[model samples]
Every structure is written in structure tokens, then in C-alpha cells.
Target chain A: MSAEMVHTVSPDGPFTSISLAIESAKNGDIIEVNSGTYNEHVIVDKTLNLVGINQPKIDGGGKGTVVLIKAPDVTFKGFHVSGSGESLSVEDTGIVLDSAQGSIIEDNSLDDVLFGIYLKKSSGTIIRNNNIVGKDLPIAVRGDGIRLWYSSDTKILNNTITRARDLVMWWSGDTLVKGNKIEKGRYGLHYMYSNNNVFEDNLFSENYVGGFLMYSNNIKFQNNIFARNQGPATGYGIGFKDLDDIVAKENLFVDNRIGLYMDNSPHSVDSWNTLEDNVIAFNDIGISFMPSIERNIIVSNSFVDNAEQVEVRGGGTLAGNNWFTNGRGNYWSDYVGYDENNDGIGEIPYKSESLFESLIDSYPNLRVFVFSPVAQAIELASDAFPVIKPEPKVTDNYPLMNYKIPQRYEAEEKGFSYKLFVVSLLMVLIPSISYVFIKRKI
Target chain B: MDTKNILLIMKKEAGESLKNRWFVLYTICFSALALLVLLFSTMGGDIAGYSGFGRTAASLINLVLLFIPLIAIITGGVSISNERENGTLPYLLSHPISKNEIFVGKFLGLLITIWFSILLGFGLAGVGVAIIGQQGDISGYLLTVLLSALLAACFLSIGFLVSVYSGKASKAIGISVFLWLFFIILGDLGIMGTTVAMDLGIKQVFALALLNPTEVFKVASVLVLSPRFEILGPVGVYAIRTFGQQGVFYLLFSILIFWTLIPLGYGYLVFTRLRREEK
Candidate 1:
């Protein structure tokens, strides 16, 4: 297919068009590019395919990587790469893949880049369906939208990262991160000392600190969602610092901010993690177990609403099949509780833990008046005068109510279509201009 | 002006506060709070016997009412603006003393180096609670370190009246660190915005948080460490039963003797109005 090996970049080609089609390509050459705006910075080094055709964009003329593959079976399809380098300690990229290998970075879009698809020391990569969009703050060129350093067998699929400060997979290993969506990030799926990973159906919303797992281990999270990660002060939705043999199941965690913050981790296996069939409406604390956490397993979860749900500081072992909607049998929209055998499971079991979470597990800034309503009326008068509930383990006898209720996910109806098209165009032009002034004053 | 020239001007102002480096950084932050209460009481009885001694005397009375008014407003805002920015107060006002013996020898050498750094940080926090607390109570850590060193000598006499009306020494250490963060974080965020605009009434939120001196030093250090927690409702039990106990010890000893006599009588009337405007 020699038209000079199908080169063709825009405005009548050759102003170093895609670096002269990677200096006149060969190993399965294809270039293409065409639709306009190509400020510069190409660098592919061989085993070609570069094809952009209609979405062609490249930019970074503001000096910083826009595309720097280095070589191996490369394939950056449908490009859009934007400006790079904001310096979170430099390593700018829009589509870097240094020390490349069998690459196939698909459907690209990256905007203000520090990194959109970086993969240094690259491996058998497949960073699919990219759409990254960063910039919220601390960006002295800090990036990472689909990063994979010290790479391995990768597959990060269905990407759509937003405001990324980190969507990484460092010290990478066998990765397979599935169905990603990740929003406003500070960390939505950060993987440190990595190993056998496999996060499935990822969503991880409004991040400031969601999905972080340091000192990584044999990972395997399933059916992920993890909503509204409120932040700026050690925020967390699914954090597992100093991690180990991890294995979370049927994950959901709604209204997060310590919805699953386990520190100094140990042999973990939090089974059937179906947390309160989540839509966790408002959070301050739902699940937090610190103090060098140990041999874990908190089965079939659900601890509704959260203003103090389940905080078991230092020392773990809360047996199988969990559920506590907060009233008598979990459903605390501030539970009043009394369901005389209508059997929706409210014959009394709701303790919902608090005494300022046992005085912040023996004082950790007694959580600055733990959201004082006079400290929630002294933790609801010490839950009607009972000194301790620190050891009441009940794991759901019959819990379930509404398992996965969030089905409005096209980015939340595309963020409510401009407020539902300005409230349906003012409800049909204010009732059709008041019936056309009462039929033109008939 | 006599008692042997005010004891030879308080022994040369205690030999320039024992060669001060802010009294050796307040004796190494009171020996690092007595080595963190002797490593949280020798980590025995599993960490201070899991919060005993009235929650470790209410967390050391909130770290001594938040760092003894920040070490008495940074040692009374650099005592007289670093002796008039190192001119050394005009050679200690041209000796032969007597401006009441150089204001009682620089207020007894800054009140004996701030009461000997609060009794060596409460005798090394009572030898770290008698070497790691849990023998029930060391009388609530000796009445919260003697009422937090008498409320850090009434905030070092209101930071020696803002370092004698601040005329540099970096404006008396930036107006005593913004008047100790405006009485500790905008006086508890203006008493939590007047207890959410007076709705959460506990006698108008304890009469507007007892006109905030950090809520009267946290309700007099939780009424001297839990005199059985009815914890001040009814306007903190009517402002401590209408200021009893000899009228709250004569209103905190007349606000610490009017911050040690109105900044040494207005710095001896501004050094006799600058020596009658230099004659």
C-alpha cells in the first residue's frame, strides 16, 4: 500500500507530518493521522500502526510528551492527546510507552496530560478505550490516568478517568483492571508493590482517596462501585494500607469516607462484601478498623446511612454474614425500631456501634467532638444507658432489601442534562405562554 | 528602689535568662511532654490501662489548654520586643536602676523563666505518672498540672500586654501570633457560630461559651477534672455558682494582677515619654 507507505497527515502533509511517518516506516507500516491539529512531538520507533484518521489531535507544543512510544508492536488508535507536564515531579506524557512491547493503546482522548497512557518498561500492554481528563490541583506535572510502571501483563480496560492525580498500577504485575470509570481522582485504583491483580467492573466515584492499596498483594475485588469519596483529610472508600493477601467480594460501598478503611493490613479476605446494598446516603463513618488490623473477614456487609455505623478499632474478628441497617435490624434512617413480627427482620439486633466509637478507640483526637450534636446526645444517651457494645457480633440472619440500586449511571444521566433541559424549557414555555394570553384576549 | 538595688537587678535578670534560647526552647518543649508521659506510662497495663485516670486527665487537659497558650504567647511575645530590638533597652535604662528597679528586674526574670518551665513540665509529668500510670490516680495528674501552670500564668500576662504595645520585634511577634490564633481558633469558631445562632440553647450556649478564654479554659479544666460529669449545663452551673471559691479566687487573681500591672505601668510611661522627648 505504497503512497509512500500510506503516510497522510493533514494540511497537505509533510511539515514533519507525524515525524515524517516515523521516518518512513516499515514493519507493517500504516501512519494515517489526518483530521488536523498536530502541534508535534511524535516518536514511535517502529512496528507501526499509529492510525488516527478522524480524531487526530496531538498538541503538547507547550513542551512535554505528546507521544513517545519507543518501539515494539505499537498501535495508538483514534488519537486526541493534549498538553502535558504540570510536574508532580516530572515524567510528562500523553501517550508514552517507553521500552515498549506488544502495545495496543485504544480509542485515545487524554487532555491536560501529565500522563494518560504511560507504561514505562512496558509489557504486553492493552490500555483500552482511553478518555482521561486531568487537573484539579497539585500538578507540578503529576499525572497517571492509565499508568503502569515496571510493567507486566496488562489489560486496563474500558477507561474513562477524570481529573486524575493517580490512576496507577506501579511496580506492575499481572494486571486486568476491568470496566473503569474513576472520577475526580487523587487516587482511584492505586496499586503499589503490585501482584496478581483483577479488579472487576470498576466505577470508583468522586475520588479524593478511593481504591488505594499500598504494599500490594494477591488482589481480587469484584463488582465494584464505591461512591462519593469525600476527602482532604485521610479520605477513604476502599483503602487497605500495608496490604496482603486481599480478596474483596461483591463490592459496593456507597457514600464513602472511611467506608472500608483498614490500616496496617494482615491476611485479609473480607468475603461477600455486599455492603448495605449500597446507596449509603451520607457518610462520616461506616466501616473503619484500624490499629494494625489483623486476620480479617467481615461477611455479607450492609450498615446503612452512616453517622457512626461500624467502627472496630484495633483487633478484629466479627463473624460471618453481616448486616445492620441501623434500626432494630439495620435500616437506620435514624431507626426508631419496632416491627412486631411483620418479619422484615426487625425483631431487634440494631446496636449500630458508638460511644464516640469507643472514645475513638481510646482517644484518637476523640474525633474532635465526633460530629457533635453534643456528641449525638452522648451517643444517644450511651444507647439508652449501656456501657459497652464493643463485642456484639451478629452476621445477618435475614438482611437484604435493595442490593444494587444505582442504575442511573450514564455519568448520572450525563449530570442531569443541563438540569433536565432547564426544567423542560420552563415546563413548556410556562404553559405555552399562559395559553397565548388566554387566546389573545378572546 | 532599694532592697539592695532590687537584688542587684534580679541578678542581672537571672543572667540574661540563663543565656536564653527562649529558655532553651522552653526546656525542650517541657522535656517533650515528659517524654510523652513516659511513653504513655511504660506501655504497661496495655497502654495506660485502656483510658483510665479520667481519660488520662482529659487528655492532659487538652494538652494543657492547647500548649499553655502557645507557651504563654511565645514567652510573652519576646519580652519587651527583644529588649527593644537588642539595643538592650538603652543599657538597661542607663543603670543605677530604679524604674522600680527596672520593672522588678524584668518581672523577676520573666517570672523565674516561666515558673521554671512549669515546674520542669510538671516534674517530668510526675515522673511519667509514677513510671507509667494505672495505679488508679495520681490525683488526676496533680490537678491537671496545677491548673495548667495557673493557666500559663494567665497567658503570660496577656503576652506581656502584647509585648508592650508592639513597636516591632516583628510587631511583637506578629501581635503574639495573632493573639494566639484569636484566642484559639477564632475563639472556638465564635463559639460554634453562637451555638448555631442560639438554637442549641444550654442557656444561650453556656452564656456564649463563658465569654471565651477558650471556653474559660474548657470549663475550668472540666471543673478540675470530673467532679462527677454533670459537665456544665445550666450555664456551666451558673458560671461556677456565681464565681464562688472566693469568687473564683478573686477573679483569677484580678486577671493575674492585671497582667502584672498594666505592662509594667505602660513600660514606665514609655520610658518617661522617651526621656521627655530627649530633653
Candidate 2:
């Protein structure tokens, strides 16, 4: 099978141009292009294997698309795709797979393109192990390392993407994005209007927004690491906005501004998401649930050495074995509590100093005094006098620190019950009232 | 004098409207806003996770209330004023038709055109909502469109009155634009100022806010569509408490009738008086 379809593209024949070689290729063929700079746009419209020997390059001549794949069961490997121009017009991707299925794009390098590889309305594709590095400073460009737009059922794995504006899956569903290293992008792994997608074992480090999930549902992120994503405008390690039914667990967020930010969402149950075992050291706030956020479960997370541990400006259920590091537990580094029990857990829960912390939060300049002796004394006095730390309301008695707990949809069920009660009451009243009047006359 | 002549004049006005650039532009702008309404409404569920009837209705009402007056004032302001400025009103008036017939025919033509635009916008919005699998409250949408159309008619009549009274085209345009802007933006600002000055509670202020036609439409539409969110403000609270659910419908109908008749009646008197003065 290898011998029958082995076609070599070199200086001879129509091999100089990629388009010419692809025109003559058959199913199960290996059209191996040799090392040269071929400035052409190649289209694969058949089920075949296309291999690039010694890293052959396809340049788009800075005008149009480089290569477009419209075939099922096709593989593009070991190529350096380059030369995508900047345009505010319609989408011009370096490599576009439009309506292609079962395609594998692996072990390729995409550089200096508007978009590295865009999968538009395509499904059942595996985009794996590609090194996509955009330009250092984007020239007013709007592109992604690998974008899946209006596509579904694709697996994106182990790809290293950097310097792109956004890594996006827009208006798509049922995707598995795992084991990728995404950095220096505007937003890492932005999911918009997509549903039922699982993102796990990914490292989103040093990005503008280290993962923004919005307008999506039934999406889960687990075992990911978010680190060093700090900028004036670029922060928020994991931000969930207007999302529902999302489950995040066993993730490590260290030294990022606002480790977990949940905003404007309701009916989302976040439980057993371990902000423990994470070095949430040196951030503005560890967890911030804003005013519009409601009905979420924030439990069993450790807040260690952050400027502010937890800022709950919203109404949500905060319960179940969580640890705060303000002298009573979990290593504040300013802890004044003696280990009377010698148990790992502190004897008393920590009482955060309120007025001082509020001042520090509103006026960040006061944070310079955070490590001062005076500040330490104040924190100790506040703890001893007990001015802060709302009383613990335990929802679950024994909360596991590391397990991925499925979010119970009990709230939704209760809401449904109320609706049913109203319906039944109306059903009973309408008929009973009419029957009584008729019976009275009779 | 006859119904056939009135119909002919209405058709002629409609045909003339099709060629008007501003009318075409207005239609496109309205269509765009309708698209935005659909996008926000559809995505609101995924973003907020509480895509109730109230939220959907609130969004639709908010869009209509914001844009309707602007469209109404612009379209209505120029309808008669532009004809007079262009020296075509006298020629049309010289025909055998009575002054009342010409006025009624033109008014009907404009109303029909604006209603057609509103329906087109709503149809597009409906398709978008369906595509996003959002089940919007149809009755709420219909109520909003109807009330908004009435509001538009009121603004149109007001604009036509200005067009009839003003000496120059520029003055008419300026006055119409200023009136719409004042009602929409400045009126809210003024309400906020008065609230602060009087130290009145937000509810009392909102009750006073209903005096502003834009705020009235906004409050009325919200009441009709989303009774649940009606308690968010003083105006809403007072409205629900005073009117109850049935009262809400009654108040809306009353407001609609009042605004519609007052402006059109004024415009009819001014227009008739102006015609006599010209003669």
C-alpha cells in the first residue's frame, strides 16, 4: 500500500508546485513534498495522506489563504505554513478546513499568519501536537492559534500556542480540548455559545485572560494550571461569565490576579474545586464572586497569602470545609494561633480583619503596609477581638478536598416543583370554581 | 371628496416613500437594532442562565422603547415639513381634494409604512429567537410592538406639528431632533436631578418620571411584558400596587390612547389653521 501510492514532489515534474502534485494524487496516496519554499494555495478535496519531507513550507504570498482542506480522512503533517496578510475584511486563515471530517493535523509549525489553522463547520478532526507561534507584536491582527468556529466533535490536544490574540471555540459544541500549552494570547481557551465541551490538563500561563468561558453550558475544566497571568488590563486566571452547569475541579491557580472570577451567572454549582494544593500567593484577590453571581457552591478551597483571600460581593452559598489562612488556619504566614490540638486543621476558623482589608482592597496603596508590624498587630487584634469572618454555615459535613463532585441540579428541580405547583393550583381552581357555581344553580 | 381619491393619494404617498432615502435608511437602522435584540435575547439565557419570560420581555421592551421615538420623530418630522419646504404641498392642496382628506390620507400612509417596518423587524427577531431555541413570550412581544407603534404615532404627530408651524425646514428639523433627544436622554437626566433636589424617594420620582413620554413607554412596556421585574423600581412598585395585573393593561391602553389622540389632535388643528392662514 505504501509503494503503490508513494509519489515524491521535488524539482522535477509538476512537483515544484503543491497544487499540481495534489491534482494527480489518489486515495491512500502519500504525496511527499520536498524541502522548498512553494508559494501556492493547495486544496485537498480527497481522502488521502499528504506528508511534507524535511519540513516543506507553504507560503500564502501574503495575499490569500495558504492551504484549504475540504476532504475527509486527510492528514497534514510536518509543514511550516506561513505568509497570512493582515485584513479587517472576511476571515483569511493560514490553513482552513472547511466542512472537512475525520482529518488529522499534527506536528506542524504555523508562523506569522492571521490565523494558524481554522476549522470552520468541520467535525471529527484531531488537531494535535502543533507548534503555532504568531508574531511577537500582533499588527492590528485578530487571529487565534487554532480556532474552531461553528464546528463540533473535534479533539484539540498537546498543541503549544503563543502570541495569538485569542484561542477560541465559537458557536461550537462537544469538543475535547486537552493537554495544551497556551500563552501570551488575549484570551486563552475562550468558549462562546458552545456547550458540552471538556477542557482538562491544559496550562494557560501568562495570557491576557487565562481562560474566559462565556455563554456556554455543561462545560467542565479540570486539572489545569493557571500561572503568572498578571497585567493591568490582563488578568483573571479563570473567569466564567454568563455560563451555566459548569464544573471546575482539581485545578491549580498560582500568583494570578483573581484566581477564580465568577460573574453574572445563576444555577451554577461549583463544589470541591480545590483552590487548595495551589500556591495562590501574591494576587489581588483569591476568589471574587460579583453581585450578579448567585446560587453557586464555593467550598473546600484554601486561600493562602493572597492580598485578599475571598471577596464575596455577591449572594451565594459559601460552605463545606473551606480553609482561610488568617491565623486560625491554613498558613496565613501571619498566623498567631497556637496549635493547641496539633491536628492539621486549626482549632478555630480564621477571622479576616475587615476594616483594614477593606481599606487595602479599595485603596491598594495601603497594601504596602500589609506586612508591616503595625498591620500584623491590627490583624491579630481583629482576630482576637473577632471583628470579621462570617459564621460557618456547613452544607456538607464531610467535604473531600480533591474529588470531582458532580454539581447537583437540586435548585433547578426545586424551581420546577414550584412551577408545577402553580400549574396544578390553576388547574384545580378553574374547574372547581365553575363546577360549584353550576351545582349551586342546579 | 370621495374614498377613491383618498386611496389614490395614500398609494401615491406610499410610492413616494419607497423612493425616499431617509425612509430606506430608517428601515435599515431599525432592522439592525432588531438583529441586536435577537442576538442579546438568544445569548441572554446562556450568559445569565435565567432565560425567563420576564428577562426576554424586558430585553424586547428596552430595545423598542429606545429606538422607536428616534425613528418616529425623524420620519414624522420630515413627512409634511419636507413637502412644504420643497413647495409640493401647495400643488397637492390645489387639487380637488379637501384639506381634511389630504391630511388623513397622508397620515394613514405614513402609519402603514412605519407599521410595516416594525413588523418586518419583529419577524426577523422572531426567526433569530427560534434559531437560538429561545421560546419568547409572543403575547409580550405583540403588546410591546403595539404600544411602541402608538408611541411612534404620537411622536410622528408631534414632529408633523413642528413641521407645520416652523417657518424654515432647518428649524423644523432642529426642533424635531431636539425634542426626541430631550425626551429620550435629557428627560431621564432631568428626572434624576429632580429626584436629588426634592430628596423624594425613588418611587415618587419614578411616578413623576411617567410624565416624560419615553419613560412612560419604557415603564408601560416593562409592566406589560415583565410584571416580575416591575418591583425593581418605585415606579414599577407603585404601578403594580395601584393597578394590579388588570390595572397594568388598563393603564397601558389609557396611556396609549391619551398620547395618540393629544398629539394627532393638536397636529390636525394646527395643520387646518395653517391651511386657512395660507389661503
Candidate 3:
């Protein structure tokens, strides 16, 4: 057997380019490339290690994929990759692992690329600690930061992605996405036909949607923060469609148009989903469910200060979904029920029954009067006259009496603004002093 | 128009309005309510969890919408009818002041009275919020105050129209109360009925909402709080899109200005013609 060798690629070395070094190396050889701009596309078809000594630059010259790894057990890291082609149809990428398995891609910075990393038919891959910025095009025209197609058992960790269309996974299963911060994109994480996936501690903000999981089943999401994904049409912190057997726990959904939007989740009649111990707060609508959504256990969550807490689209009640489990229910900010006998559960059930809100669910145009005195009057009148009270959209018999804010949102408390203080004081003093002066003069 | 006569009547009306019992009571009630809204908005931070200027401003806007127009209409509706019923209008007309001066002077005086009370209410509440060290949006609060004062002026103009049309104070009060109920309930019914009956689009709903001054006030206040129109649902989004952010403010202001001018102008023409007929 031949001994594995280390080949050097430098301006002054035997091989001046990375492709030349790869050509000169064996199947399991190491190619160490020094810090220099290589303005050519390179393809590695053998098992090799490509290590950038001082973070070398791979400039694609706005052409095709900068680096294509077609072999398994390839290690590519410590490089700045840029200048990929702009054609979305051709799927230009900074790094492409085609049918490659067990590859490690880490510590790379990719910018001005259509797709930052494309994993096609690759499994058991680890993509870690990369900063990916997509091309400066229209959001529709922009490509994804990391795209996994037909790839399974991949781990994506701690990568910062921005200004891309989406970090998408298609037909990928058993993927672990953790500690990633995604902002200013279309969909932060777009999942489709993926199963047995786990997402934890991801921060998705300022995108059209934080994460949308569609189809496939048995996914778990925990401690993920979805915030400020306020698109006009699809501003959802997280959404589920045709999904089954999902568990989302201890997640924070805040400041989105709709905190959690569900449509036909737990699709099979025997399947069920669980959403527990989440904080859904300050959104326009919290936990908007489609009419046919059923068989979901939603308990021990905090629904705080949402404009509308439990809205059933298409004008039907959420009686199919269970709001309480084992005498435990979610904490609702607008819950008017009392807890007698020193129990944590409220004696009177928490019922979401606002006549105006129900009308709005049926007729969306009535939302024009939201936050107006007319809406308040309708609610007050309904409270005064129970005969006019509409049926409850949701009922939690053992509603929890207390909620603790998650630490992630608790850390964002802003300090006092002295400017506001001074202005308010002025607002008070100027009017009072002027009123007195005007009266005395009169 | 005699400038000296107008100024003299304005001062006399202002002095009288300042001494009125209802005016004083509304001032106190509005301030107390504003303070309570501010306090509750901040205190609910532990429960509902969001406390800041935005929440306070929204609650204050509702409080202003419910009370400001009622106070303005009641006070302004009876301004002329009370004088006419007590024979003071004839007495004042007997003076050198022309009818034009008296009309403009009364409107300006009553507007100032409304402005004073609104200022005091928002101001005291602002001070309480500030001293408590709660975070708030000062500019938004100020804009709400400005919008509230404009709303008061618009209702005052409508009230003046009612004052001139009605002969007795009791009739004026009845008309004012009825108009108040109509405007408040109009927003609810207009949206509910049109949407339920016809399923009108957002553009049509916004057009209908613009017809009512109360709706305009509510929309403008929401815009101030959330410029992105996130909380207002589709109507706010439509408004922001049709008129740009700055354009919505201008549009609302012009609508309110139109509301104020048309009624006041018609009221002036009718009041002057009626006085001539009486003479």
C-alpha cells in the first residue's frame, strides 16, 4: 500500500492551484492550500482532505459552483467562498456536496452566492460554524443559504444565515438543526417531506416566517425563538401543515402576525400532536387554527397579550382540539376565571367567546374595526348580557393561574428612557402652567 | 369681521367655558381615566407581559375616542342653544359685535376649552407614566394627544351645527346625544353590516370607516402606535399600502380638516341667516 502524502498548493510551490494539487494527490491524500485567490472552479472526485492554511479565497468568478465534492469522507473548511453564478435554475452554490456522504464542512464564510451550500443526496454530513449571505437580489430571486435535498442524518449547527430566500430541507430526514441564527430572509427554515427531525435553540427573526414544517411526521422542536417574522400575508412564527406526531415544547413565539398557525396537523385520525410549555405572546393572533384541526393536546403554554388569543379561521370552534390535559391548561392573559380553594387551576373554565371576534372570524373585513371603541363596546355589551354571548371558541376547564416568562424574552427588558421622562414631565407642566397663565391673563 | 369684537367675544366665551361645571368635571374625569389607563397598562406587565408606551398609547386612544367626542358634542351642542333659550343671543346681538364675530369667536373659544382639558388629561397621565419609570413612546403619545384634540374640534364643529339647528337647549342636548350614539354605533354597524351583508373588500370597509370621524380617529391612533399596521389587520395594511406611511397621516389629517370645515361653514351660514330672519 502507498503511504498517504501531503501536497502543498501555493503561488511559489510545485502546485500553484488547488485543482493541480488534487490532481497530483492520491485518494486519501491531504491538500493544504495557502492563502491566495484561486479564480477557478474545482471538483474533487476522490476521498481527500482540502484544508485552507490561512483561509484561502475561492472566487467562482460568478460562474458555477465554487467547490464540488463528489466523493465521500471529504473534509472542506477554513475558506472564504464567493462569486457563484446567479441562475437559480442551475442551482449555483458556493459549496456543493453531490452524492457525497460523511463529509465535514466547517468554518467557511460564503457571500454573494446564489446558494451558500447545496447538499444533494448526501447523508451523515456535518455543516457547522459557517456564515452564509446570499446574493443581493429580490427576495423571490434570491437562493437559499443552505439547501439539503434528499440528504438525511445531517447536522447543521451554529451557522448565521441572512438575506437568503430560505434554509430549506426537501425530502431530508433525521436532521438536527441547532444554535443557528437566521434573520432577514423569506422563510428561515423551510421543511418539506422531512421526518424524525429535531430543532433546538434556533433563533429566527425578521424573516417572513420563522420555520414552516409541512408534511412528514415525528418532528420535535424545543427552545427555539421565533420572533418578528411579520410578512403581510404569511407572518408566522412557526407553522404546521399536514404534519403528524409533532412535539413543540418551551418555544417562544413573539411579535409575529400569527404566533402559531396550524392546518390539518396530526393528519391521520389516530395521530396526535403536542404543543406544551411554550410562550406565545404579543402577536396579532396567537395559535390560529383551521376549522378541521383536531386531536392536538395544547397544554401548559402561556398565551399572553395577543390581540386575539385563539382564533379559528373559517368561523368554526376549536372544540376538536384539547385545551386541557390531566387537569392542566395553558395560562391565558385574558382569562377572567378565578381560582378558589388555593388551587393553581381556575375554578371557572377559561372560555374564549367574544361576539366581535367571532364575527371577524366569519367575516374578515370586520377586522377594520379592531382596537376601536366599537369592538370594545360589543365585548362589554356581551359581558353585560349573556344572552348575546357567542359560543366559546375554546374552553379550558382547568386553566392555569400562573405563567413564568421564558428567560430568553426576559433578558430583553429595556431600561428607562430619560427622554420620555423629560418629555412627559414637559407634557404635564406646559399644559398646566399655560392653562394657569391663560386664565390669569383672561 | 371686527378683530376687536371677535377677540372680546372669544375671551368672554373662554372665561365662561372655563367656569362651566360639566367642562370641569369632564376635565377631571378624563385625566383620571388617562392616569388609570397608563397605570394599568404598566402594571399588567407581569401578567400580559408587554408594558411600554405603545400599550399605554393604545389604551389612551380608546379612552379618548369614547369620551372626547361626547364631551365636545355636549358642550358645543348647547353653546348657542343655551344662549338663545336664556335670551343671551339677542342680548349679545344687540351689541356692536357682528354675527360673524360672535360665531367664529364662540367656535374658537369652545375649541380652546376642549384643547385645554385634553392637554391637562394627557399631560397629567404623561407625568405619572414618566415618574413611574415605565418605558413609553413619547412621540406617539404626543401624536395621540394631537389627534384627540383634532377629534374634539371635529365633533365641536358638528355640535355647532346641531346648536344652530335646534331651538331649545333640551333639543340640542338630545340631538347631541343621539348624534354621539349614531357616530359610535355607526362604526360598528357600518363595518359589521357591510361586511356581513355584502362581504365587501378591505378598500370598501376602509372607505366606510373614513366616513365616521370616530373611526378615523381610531385608525389614525392605531397608525401612530403601529406604523406597520400589524395590529390593525388588513385594513391597516391596505391604508399603509394605498397611502404611504407619511401619506396616511396627511390623508387622515385632511379628512379630519374636511370634517371640521364643512359642518362649521354650513353652521355659520345657517346661524347668520336665522339671526337675520329673527331680526
Number of the top-ranking candidate, with TM-score as the measure: 3
lDDT of 3 by residue, A223-335 (tens): 98898888867899999999999999999888788999998898999999999999887778998998968999999999877889988897778888899999899999889
- Backbone clash pairs for candidate 3 read B53-B136
Candidate 1 lDDT over A300-322, as tens digits, reads: 34444455566666433354333
List lDDT for all candidates, in order. Answer: 0.62, 0.65, 0.86
- Model 1 global lDDT (CA atoms, 0 to 1): 0.62
What would the TM-score be for candidate 1 when compared with the true structure? 0.37
| Residue B74 C-alpha lDDT in model 2 | 69
Provide per-model DockQ scores.
0.01, 0.01, 0.48
For model 1 chain A, the run of ten residues with the poorest summed lDDT: A409-418
- Candidate 3: list runs displaced more than 4 Å: A1-16, A33-36, B19-24, B44-56, B234-247, B276-278
Regions of candidate 2 where Cα sits further than 4 Å from its true position: A1-4, A265-279, A292-300, A313-339, A360-442, B1-279
lDDT of 1 by residue, B111-201 (tens): 6556666656655455444433234344544555556656666666667667666645788778878877776656555555455454455
Question: Residue-wise lDDT of candidate 2 within A352-383, one digit each (tens)?
Answer: 44545543443332332232223334545555
- Per-residue error for A69 in candidate 1, Å, reads 18
DockQ-based CAPRI category assigned to the predicted complex of candidate 1: incorrect
Could you tell which candidate, 1 or 3, scores higher by TM-score?
Answer: 3
Worst 10 contiguous positions by lDDT, candidate 3 chain A: A408-417
